[model samples]
Structures are given as structure tokens and as C-alpha cells.
Target: MTQRTNVVVIGGGQAGLAAGYHLRRLGIEHVILDAQAAPGGAWQHTWDSLRLFSPAQYSSLPGRLMPSQEGELYPDAAHVVGYLADYEKRYELPVQRGVRVSAVHRDGAQLRVEGDADDWRARAVVSSTGTWTRPFIPAVSGRREFTGRQLHTVQYQAPAEFTGQRVVVVGGGNSGAHIAADLAHAGVDLTWVTQRPPRYLADDIDGRALFDVATARRRALEAGHTDTGGVASLGDIVAIPPVRAARDAGLLRAKPMFTRLTTTGVEWADGTRADVDAVIWCTGFRPALAPFASLRLRATWGHIATAGTRALDEPRLHLLGYGDWTGPAPATLIGVGRRPARETARQIRELLA
Candidate 1:
């Protein structure tokens, strides 16, 4: 027998929790399904040195403030994970951990979610399965021929492991920059490679600044204004203290993208070859929507086409926290995700009412 609910949230991460929080407020019958044994969603998978670009206050969900260490501003991954677990407990939100949803499909007017151990029939589904599990490593010729160790940030733990080794860190995103810096500080000979120049905001600009201008950025796009010279992109690199210190020590510098992987290291576009011990790829990720492959609504960009977080082709489905393509800064910790989560719950509540 399939259990029935008004809504089924597809993840237990921040996006899923936010959806559950709002649904509970409306007295809606819903359940958030998490595959992990514990709370923390993607936070549990982040490297130990990773910290939120925003302060605790700026990283909060709707009903609670994320607490950090007494003197600390940005909370680390563990703190955020603990807060999320506590938030679920505090609200008594119906979350069933260890239940990995394998498929979601149309079942009359309700959607059926099949799990490894059971199944659920719900009026609507909110998918917030984030991208951490699907790390991106660009294909370079001879990458398979390289004899050295290669890892993405997904598998990275402490920088202590790469001590005294020559390393090449690829990509210029936040993860790439921090991982490269950490490896460099750990006595590793490091070279940073990027396809383009990395953008670094002023020290004063943090995640808060990015959140503050999200609305303006949305409006500007709606007005068809193309010249967005001064606006800060949500994904633009922030000048955190560690990165700043790395810059001061001249460790956080960039090299142009290399053309191919060599037996030992990489071959640059200029035909120069370098010998390195390992290469850490931090190219980022795509959405984790493989479970809904049967839905057949995914666009060519590997995302389900959505109208305000609502899947355009499937009205009962909503995709959250994938990235800006879904909604402005929905993937961020203290970003503009809450509003969409709240709105998603409200819309589903009305539809199922």
C-alpha cells in the first residue's frame, strides 16, 4: 500500500527543509525524504576547511537563525549541519531519513515516489536534491593516461594528505580557490588553472551583499537591461579572510587553462609541459535529477524547465536549490531560496486544498 501525502519534498537539505517548514506552517500534510542517515544534506559532504561566505545571521532559513561559534561570523559546515538537524527536531517536521527515492511519476492526479523500501503517493513533489553528489570534471585529452592521483572537491577531505607534493588545481570557482589555497598552505607546490580571470569582490563584500542585490538583479533582467556592469553576480568569488591571506602570501594566483593532461601533469595551450603529482578538479556540478528521468521534462541544459520554481511542463513538480536558473540564488545558504520555498509550499497547498 502506498502512503499518501499532500506534498513530498525530495531532499532534506536546506531547500527541502525550507519547503517542509512552510508546508507545516500551512497545516499541510507533507514528508521530506532524505537518503542520508543523518541531517546536513550536502553540508556533510563539504571539505573540512569549507566555510559559508555569509555570516550566521545571513545564512539562516525562514524560522531560525543559524548559530556559530561565539566570535565567529561565518558558520562552518558542521555547525550548519547541526542547526539543520535541530531545526527538523524543533518543528517536528516529518522527515524520513535513509529513504532514497528512486523514481517519481504521474499517478492519477497524485505523484508516486518509489523508494528502496517503500512508496509514497503525494499531491505534489518538490525536488531539492542538490548537486554535491554530481561533481563535474571536465574531459581533457590524456586525462585517463595520467598516472597521478586525481580528485574533485567532493572527495577532498583535509589538506594534510597532499603535503610536499606538486599539485595542479583546476577551475576558479569558490571551491577550487579554497582547496588550492588549503593545499598550498599545507606545503604543497600548487599551480591554479582557470578558463577565465577570477573575479574577487572587495573584502567588505560578502554573501550579504550578494543577497541584498538579488531583487535588483531580477528586476534589471526583467526590464531587458543587458549592461550589468556594477551588479555583483551571486556566484562571483568573495574575498574571505583566508583567501585574502593567501593573496597576501602570493599563493592565490591563476594560470591559463591547459590543453591536455600529460602522463605526469598537464600540457598548456602555449605548448609548455609541467610535471605534477596530482590534479584537483573543481569545475562545479549539475543538478541531481536522475531519479526523475521518467518525467522527461529536462531541458538540453540538464535542468527541468521551470516557471518560478514550478516545472513548466509538469505543474505538480517544483525544482528548488539547483541554481539561478530555477530562481535567483536558490542554491545559496542565506540566499533568496526561502521565498521560493515558501511560495512553492503555498502554491502546492492551494492546489491540493
Candidate 2:
């Protein structure tokens, strides 16, 4: 038997919680399916040292603000996880943990969401499963021949794991820079490998600035104004404390990505080889859209067509926290990530009302 609801939300992380919050406010009956046993979304799985690039005030959901601790510049992962748990409880968002949703399909005008042990039939579905679970690792030649240990940032907990080991940190994002910096400070022989030179924002710039820029761009587009161009991307690594310290110490140096993986380490494009013990890929992740594959909604350039958080091709189908396409700043905690869910909920309510 399949239970039904007004809406079904996939994921219980920041995006899911935001969606659940909005739906609850709209008096919409909804169920949030969470794969994690706990309330926090992907924050629970982040490395122990992971901290938000933005301040606590900036990194909040739709309702309550994320409280910061005394003398804390950026809140750590545990703080975020704890905050999310408290947020859900505070709002009394209905969340079912430990339920892994396999797929969602269109059953007439409604959505049928199938999970491990439960199935939900809902008029609408909000897919908030962010990209944390599916960490991307670039395919390099001779990848299988590498004798050294390899792990993605998804599996990285602490730099101490590679203590005394020569490690190559791959990717040009904040995670790569942070991990490489942490490893260097942890006494690990580390090399930073990037496809392109990692871009760094000004010393004063951080996640908040990134969000501001993105929001401005969105507002410009919405207002039918021509973009002046030269907007900086939020994807550029913010010079957080560790990264800044690493830069000041000249430990933030990065090398071009190697052409191929060698038996021991990696081979440069020039055919030069470096012996190493491990490689930590912080490449990037694809959106966790697998659970919604059956919807058959079209995607162009890896994004589901959306009109302000509402699916352009499918009624009552919305994606949150996937990326900028879903919303102005859907992926960031401090950014306008909460906007998509609120807008989606509003639209669904208007349609159903």
C-alpha cells in the first residue's frame, strides 16, 4: 500500500529542511525522506575540520538563524549538524530518516516516490538531495595502475590520516585548498594538483560576498537588465583562515594536473613522474538526481529546466539545492539557497488552492 501526501521532499539537509519549512508554513501536508539516521543533511558527513566560509548569521535556513559560538569565526560541521537538528525540531518538520528513496515517477498528475520500505504518492515532489553523496573524481589515464591509496573528499575526515605520507590533493575548489593546507600543516608531504590555477578571491572576500554577487546577478536578470559582466564566481575558493595561513606560508602552491596515474603516483604532462602515497580528489559532484530519473523531465547542460524553482516541463516538480539553475544561490548556506523552496511551496499552494 502506498501512503499519500500533498508533497514529498527528498533529503533532510539544508535544502530539504528549507522545503519542509515552507510547505509546513503553507499548510501543505508533506513528508521529508532522509537517508541519514540523524536530522542534519550532508553536514553530518563532512570532515571534522570543515567550517562554513560565511559567518553563522549568514548561514541560515528560511526561518531561524544559525547561532555562532563565542570567538568562533565560522561554525564547524558539528555546529551546523546540531543546528539543523534543532531547526527541524523547532519547526516540527515531518522527516523520516533512514529511508533511501530509489526513484520518483509520474503517476498521472501526481508523483510516486518509492523508497526502501515506504512509498509516497504526492501531488508534488521537491528533490533536495544535494551533491555531497556523489563526489566526482576525474578520470585520468592509467588510473587503475596507481598503486597509491586514493580517496575522495567525501571520505576525507582528517589530515592525520595521511600523516607522513606524500599525498596529491586534486581539484581547484575550496575543499581542495583546505585539505591541501590542512595536510601541509599536519606534516604530510602534500602536492596540490589542479586542472587550472585555482582562483582566489580578495582577502576580505568570502562566502557572503559570493552570495551577494550571485544575488545581484539574479536580480538583474529578473529586472530585465543587461548584465554588466565581470561578476566574480562563487566557485572560487575563499581564503579562509587555514587557506590564508597556507598562502602566507607559501604552502598554497598548486601544480598542473598530471596526465596520467602511475604505479606509484602521477605522471606530468611532460612525462615527468612524482612518487606519492595517496591522492585525495576534491573534483566536484553531480546533482543527486538519480532518485528522480523516472520522471523523464528533460535536462539541458546538466540542469533541469526551471522557472523560478518550478519545473518548466513537469507540473509540481521542483529541484532545490542542486545549483544556481534551481535558485540564485541554492547550494550555499548563507546564500539565497532557501529561496527556491519558499517559491516552490508558494507556487504549489497557488496551484492546489
Candidate 3:
């Protein structure tokens, strides 16, 4: 007999885990299917030295508190992964690891999910894969010609691994700023290249959180409106303390946007070239919706198109963790994620009923 569930959650990271936790609490029968051998999706592969900018209070899952105190800076990647593992144990969430979902299709009133081994039938499907699956590297010419080691931020682990190398970090986002600073401190010659000078804000600016601006901008864009284009320019949002410190140290410089990749290094739009030993593309990520390509997508640029979490056409297919669905306060931290998950779960429950 084919395995069946009330709901099937794809991607067993924080989002999927949260969905499972809520479903169980509501007495909804569900199973979580994760691609990786373990939980903590991108965190499992994040750089070792990285720490959460959000405090511990903002990082907790639905029922359990993140094992830290209020106002304390959240733990590193390892700590987060450990916490996720513990969450799975605590809830005994029925997650099937190592099972990659190939596709999800609707069959009559049920959803059919094909995986590496077998197919699953569920009354409904919650795609909690989140936004970090596909890394966005702009199509720059001569990237393949670059002789230097080129890697995405998703692959970056630590500066110790790139010590003694001349590194060119591309993009001006949070990841790029952090990586450039870290590697430069580790005795590596570093240059950060961004198309536009980012507007840096203090982590707390004028008693208004920087993330609040980001969350607001994201929500605006998601609503088919644009607010100076999604927090790319730091001047619009508050800067984190570390970013301010980096700026004060003169370690961060805004360069032209990426133009092309050469074997020796990267070339910028201004025709400037850097012969880098390593190229760290801290560009950012795109949602992985390839599995659902058959479904009509409401999109702008490459991101999914939805009015808030509800799909424009298909209300059953909801998207969470989008750039601005929760307005300014809830979009930037894990804490904000809970509200959306709760709302989405409620909607899913209603749909199933």
C-alpha cells in the first residue's frame, strides 16, 4: 500500500519543522520529508564562524524556547543545528530524511508527491522550503575563464579556509559585508564590489530597528509595489553594529556591480579588474520553485508572485518567509517566521477541513 498522510511537508528545516509541530499540536496527521540527511537546511552548510544577528529571543521555534536568554545574540551555526536536532527529538516529528521530493501533483482531492524511492499521497501539501535553496549568481561573462577559485556564499565556511588569498567579494548584501570583513581580518587581501553604495544603518537606528525597514520594504515589493528596491541600499535601513565597525575600520568599500567573471578574477561595470586568488560570490539566493514550475506562478523578476502568503491564483499554494509578507518587524528574524507559519497552518487546516 502507498504511504498516505493528512499533510506532507517538503524541506525539513525550521519552516517545515514548525509546520509539523503545529500540525501535531492540532492533531493533524502529517509527515515531513527532507532532502538532506539531517535537518537545519542551509545552516548545516553555513560558515562555521557565523553568528545570528538576531537575539536568542527571536530564534525560538513554536513550542520550545531557543536555549538562550533574552537580548543575547543568537548562537552560531552549529548551535542552531544542534537545537534543530533536539527539536526533532523533543517532538518526535515524523521526518523522513534523505528523501528528496521530485515533484508534487494534485490527483483528484489528494496531492501526490514523488520522491527518490516511492510516492506519497497527502490530503494537502505545505511547501516550507523557504527562500534559500537556489543561489543567485548574476550571469557575468568570463566567469568560467577565471582561474581563481570561485565559490558562492552558500559554499563559504570560514576565512581560515581562504587565508593568504587575495579575495574579491561580490555584492553588498549582509553576507558579502560580513564575509569581506571576516576574510580581511584573517590576513587576506579583500575587496568588496557592489553596484551601488549600500546604505549602512546601525543595528538599532534612532530606536527603530534596521530590520523593520527591510521587512517593510520587502512587504511593499511583495504587494506589487516597490520601496527603493528591497533594502539593498543600506542608507534606507539601520546598520548592524558589526557592519558599522567594519565601515569604521575602512575594510568595506562599495565597488561597481558584477559585470563578468574572468579566470584570474572578476571584472566590474566600471572596467576595473581585480586579480583575486578567490572569488566569493555573496550575491544572495532565489526561491527554488523548479519542482512546482508546472503550476502557474505569479512572479516578478524570479521570485514567486503572491499577495502576502497566498498565491495570486492558487490560494492553496502558500509561500512563507518571503521578503516582506509580515511587514517590517516580522520578516527579518526567525521570530517573525512563527506568525506566518501559524497563519498558514490555520489556513491549511481550514482547507483540509
Candidate 4:
């Protein structure tokens, strides 16, 4: 027999938890289904050296502030993990871990969420599945022929494993910069590669600045004005302490994109080749919307077409914390909790009413 709920939130990451918090506050009965066996969501999978670009005080979800770490201005992955775990308990969120939702389909007027061992019929389905599982590694010719190890950001751990080896880290994003810096200090001959020149935000800029810029852009667009440059125009990479230090010390220089992967390393179109031990793909990820395939809601960009959080194609479906498409900075811990989660819950409450 399928259990019944007012709402069923898939993927108990920050997005899912935020959805739960608001739903409960509005007196909406909901259940959050998380695939992981523990809390921390994607934080559990991040590399040990991963640090938030924002300070603990600035990186909080609604209803609670993330306590400051005694010594660290920017908290590490483990600290965030602890905060998320504690947040789950403090709010008394109804999260069922280890329940990987396989599919969501229409069942009469309700949506049917099928898990491994159980099924739920919810009035509405909130898909908060962020993109940690679907890591994207661009296809370069001869990738299969490469002999050395190749891994994505999700697979990366500590830098000790690559010690004494020549390694190439690909992509221009924060992950690329961070990994290259990490590997550079770990005794590896490290090379960072980017398709375009890496853009670095000012040393003062952090997650708070990014959000404010995004907000300004949205406001400008809404007021029928030209683009105010937004976050993209400012820069892609935030100049965190380690990354900035690495850049200042000349450790984080990035090379141009290679045309293809050779047996040993990458080769440029100009026939320039670099021999390396491993290639770490710091490429980004796509939305984890495989379970929602039956709903036929995703657009050409592999994201659900949404008017606010509501899916344009499926009204009962709301997508949260995927990225800018869902809501303003909804992917961030503060972003999701600040507006999207509350707005989504309010919309759901209205729908139920």
C-alpha cells in the first residue's frame, strides 16, 4: 500500500531540507526522501580540502544560523556536514534516508513516488535533487585511450594519492582552481587547464557578493533595464584565501583547453602535448532529474522549465535548488532557504487550500 502525504520532497540535500522546514512551518504534512544513508547530502562526497566561499555566518539556512567554527573563517566540508546534520535534527524534519526515489508518475490526482522498498502518494512532489550525482566530463577524443587515471570532482579526495606524480586538472571553475592548488602543494607537478581564461572575483567577494550580484541582475531585468553585468560579468572564480594565495604565488596558472586526450596526457590542436600522470575533470554537473523523466518536464538545457518553482509542464511538480533556473541562488544553503523554499511551500499551501 502506498503511504499518503501532502507533499513528497525528493533528495534530502539542502534543497530538500529547506522545502521540509517551510512545509512543516505552514502545517503541511510532507516527507523528505534522501538517497544517502546519512545526513550532509552532497557535502559528504566533497573532497576533504573543500571550503565554502562564504563564512559560516553568511552561509546559513532559514530558522537557524550555522555556528562559527572556532578557528576557520571559512568552514570546511566536515563543518558544513555537521551543521546540516544538526539542522535536520533541530527542525525535526521528517527525512527518511537510504530511500532512493526511482520514479515519479501521476497516480490519479496525486503523484506516485516509488522508492526501493516503499511507495508514496503525495498531493504534490517537490524535486530538490541537486546535481552531485551527474558529474559531466566533456568528451575528448582518445579519452578511452588514456592510460592514466581520470576522475571527476565528485571522485576526488585528498591530494596525498597524487604525490610525486605529474597531474593535469581540467576546467576553469572553482573546483579546477582548488584541486590544482591542492595538488600543487602536495608535491605533484600540477597543470590547470581552462577553455577560457579563468576569471577571478575580487579578494573581498564571496558567496554573499555573488548572491547580491545575482539579485541586482534579477532586479534590473524585472525593471525592464539592460543587463547590469550580474555575477558572470564580475568573474567566475571567487578569490578565496587558498585560491588567491595560490594565484599570487603563481601556482594556479591555467592552460588552454586541449583538443583531445592522448595515451599519456592531453594534446592541443596546435599539436602541443603535455605528459601527465592523471587528469582530474573539474567540469560541472547537470541536473539529477533522471527520476523525473516520465514527467517530461525538463527543457533543452536538461533542466525543468519552471515559472518560479512550479514546473511549466507539470503543475504539481516544483523544482528547488537546481540552480538559477529554479529560483535566485536556490542551490546555495542560504539561497534555497531564503526565498525559494518558503515561496514553494506557500504556493503548495495555497494549492492544497
What lDDT tens digits, residue by residue, belong to model 3 across residues 1-353? 36898888887888777778878887888888888997776689888667776666556778887787344464678788888899888999999999888777767778788888978998777776766768888778887787878889988988888777788888776788878777766768888878677656555552134455565666566677857544445453234565566778877777777688777777767787777798888888877767666665667776676655656656666665545542233333353445666776787789888
Model 4 lowest lDDT segment of ten: 295-304
Sorted on TM-score, best first, the list reads 4, 2, 1, 3
Candidate 4 Cα misplacement greater than 4 A, ranges: none
* Model 3: CA > 4 A from native: 69-72, 203-242, 268-271, 325-336
| TM-score of model 3 (CA atoms) | 0.86
Models, CA RMSD each: 1.7, 1.5, 3.5, 1.0
**Per-prediction backbone clash count:** 0, 0, 19, 0
lDDT (Cα, tens digit) per residue for candidate 1, span 7-110: 89999999998888888999998999999899989899888888888889889988988876676777788889999899889989899999989999898888
The CA lDDT of each predicted structure is 0.84, 0.84, 0.72, 0.90
Superior by lDDT: candidate 1 or candidate 4? 4
TM-score of 1: 0.96
Off by over 4 Å in 1: 222-235
lDDT of model 2 at position 98 = 96
Q: Which is superior by lDDT, 2 or 3?
A: 2
Name the top lDDT candidate.
Answer: 4
Compared with the true structure, the alpha-carbon lDDT of candidate 3 equals: 0.72
- Candidate with more favorable, higher lDDT: 3 or 4: 4
